[model samples]
Target: MAESQLLCMEDGLMPTAVPESRPQFYYSEQHRAALERLITGGDGAFKSLLKDENGQDFLSAREITAITSSFVKYKTDEENGGASAGQDKRDDAGSLHSTYWPQMSDTEVPPLDIGWPSSGLFKGVTRVAVHTHPPKDNGPHIKEVVRKLIQESSKVVAIVMDLLTDLQILRDLFEASKRGVPIYIVLDEPGAPHFLDMCNRLQVGARDLQNIRTRTVKGIGLNLSVGRIPGNVQSKYMLIDGDKVMFGTYSFSWSSSRMDRNMITVMSGQVVDFYDNDFRELYAISDKLDLFKQFHMTKPQTGTLSRAAVPKRPAAATSRFQVNLGDVTRGDGKVPAHKYHNPKYLLALGQIPGPTEPLQDFFNKMEPPDPETEQELENPTEELENLTPDPSPPEKKKSKKLKLSFKSKRGKKDKKSDEVIEENPANPSDEASKHTLTRDETQDSLKKKNTECMCVIA
Candidate 1:
């Protein structure tokens, strides 16, 4: 047999198990309606993490118990008569009540009266309007109010939370900048990076516009240095044209209006001036967020000695001893034993020399003698006699005498003449007589010689 095919399977006979899907927790229609009501109501400040994208409350079991506890507390408070019950609801309900329905302390000033009215002339009727979110059913939206404020105002000063991804609000601010309205924004230091990034993106967009003269857009970082307490600039407000002021828990962001519960109050009066003044003071003190300063660490300045006025001490004892010995040796080494039996040495330290002769007289006294110049100075008459001129003229050299002889041709009678001629070889005329005569003079002399020969021949 094949084991009877009907083997009793213990696990198969247990049960046909169907896997359970993740238990879907959703808000009821009543719960959704209540949340909307709560948001629209004065309890709009209550932050909710229960609501989903489809407007459904996906509260966990623990969250539901927390919500139930809140309802129970609300019922108890209603039975007792709300805030007038004089009971500390925060203490009674613990974290739930404290988070959802925080009790306003007596000392806490309302956001609307942040600025007090100054003592000045009330010229015109001060217009005032209060707006809260989730906004009232009949009134203007908070976003629209902000847009209108930005569009109409000549200048805007604001302090707000992190300017996150809020295109509509950022676009309105950019438009305000394009209109040449000076906008001064002060942000908490932590949110400064995000706010600066948003401003850079806005600037990049503004670059494309033609002839669009943009106004001054300045930002400042608020330094809240409190230990481990997570200090932040929690004050959210705006001052327009120093005349109108809008302030509240509201933020300049889309999530603040659409998701987060906040409030804003628009007021125009002498009171606004006070807020404007406060903003100016705060803005003046706020620091600028420079990336180079934040990241590029700098070394602390070290103190240096001044070269111009350095203190110098007197010479050392050994050097002073050597200097004194040298000074003593420069003069006579013999000690004056008669003046002092113990031979006390006289130190000339710090002593100024007494004024004696003038510099010229001293130089004259020290001048050295010149032997030749002294001799000339002592016998001036002998020098003059040596320099005088001689009276007799010099004699000239004697000239030499030369004898000349003349011989006649054989046809004529021979003649010899003895003549004595005083000749000086050194004289110019005697030197000329030794040279050859001119051709004309030679011919005339020859003719005269021939005539004399003819006479001789005749």
Candidate 2:
């Protein structure tokens, strides 16, 4: 019975009255003993295990997964220029990876042992947990770990991540920062826009950034990386309170954990010493991120610009135009002005260019209409042909008056000066030049006009 205890049996051996009638065998112990010998007995042991019962051994899912992970880690190490780290510790970075080795951060860690100096891997593992996520799931397991780490942190918190836009994780960090624990964060420079926007959405004030210091890092990890992009920070690890380290492929952003497979390992021991030092070096080499200066955030402008100098269009004309549009179809068959009849309104609305001026000055830089060809502002339908003209366009010279809507070199003129151009037809180009508007002047005039129009309608 004592020997049988070694086996992981869900159900115990059956009790029997004739215990000594037949010999009892603990086959599990024998199998365990044989497997232990095979692992310790060198290459010859594996040869025997591989050729069992006239058959060849085949790799399981676990073996295939391990091989895939190994290849991925190997490629990542090569990119960081620490590919030989597993072979020789003295050659380059032993385990930690960096662009500037040794100086960037000391690659040396506590020597591997069975006690406290188990080289940051584990010491009795204090606590061990494993989690897996399927496609299209939140994968809240790793998130809970990080939230708890920040919540329980006392001394300091440092995070070096490629991206850090997780709302829940950022809120946890905000709370930790409020508790007066100095939080140091390093993110990729390429993700600055999203990081700043995240802070703003969380209502994190600019002044609060003083407690939660941040920096952005760019460029490939090593100089020898030929085709690597210069926009990624790539490293993902966190050192908490100087004793615990949580490091893995788990991203605190929109990808990885939730949308793909990732792993996070948390360990507490003297192991965190190397990561703490590494974080300090990463922080030193990175550039400071000022939310205010980086995003150009400021108080939104309040008041509108002064429109005293802008000539206001007639308010009565607006009312008349609305009455025509509102009651045209309802009452005794009234009609709004046709598009062709009002050249000034068409010019302002960008339907057509005026004879004296191109609309590129006032509108969205539309090319001027051909001077010889007349632009049809609207389709000439049966009803449109009957609509009368608005007062915006010029009337016949023999009528009551010719309105000069633009300012003149002679200053503000009464009705008498309005007919000066039509009565004295000296130089049409020279007369038109007096009223020609610069782009800036036209924009200002339109802005003021649009403001009043929007107020009355909106």
TM-scores, all models, native as reference: 0.33, 0.35
Tell me the lDDT of candidate 2. 0.55
In terms of lDDT, the poorest run of 10 residues in model 2 is: 109-118
Model 1 worst lDDT window (10 residues): 221-230
**What does candidate 2's lDDT look like per residue over 317-433, in tens digits?**
344364333333344322234533466655444433223444445345444544423434233462133222226434442342223332233433431212112222334346356
Q: Give the TM-score of candidate 1.
A: 0.33
Clash count, predicted structure 2: 0
Candidate 1, RMSD to the unseen true structure = 34.1
Stretches of model 1 off by over 4 angstroms after superposition: 1-125, 156-165, 200-230, 290-458
Per-model lDDT: 0.48, 0.55
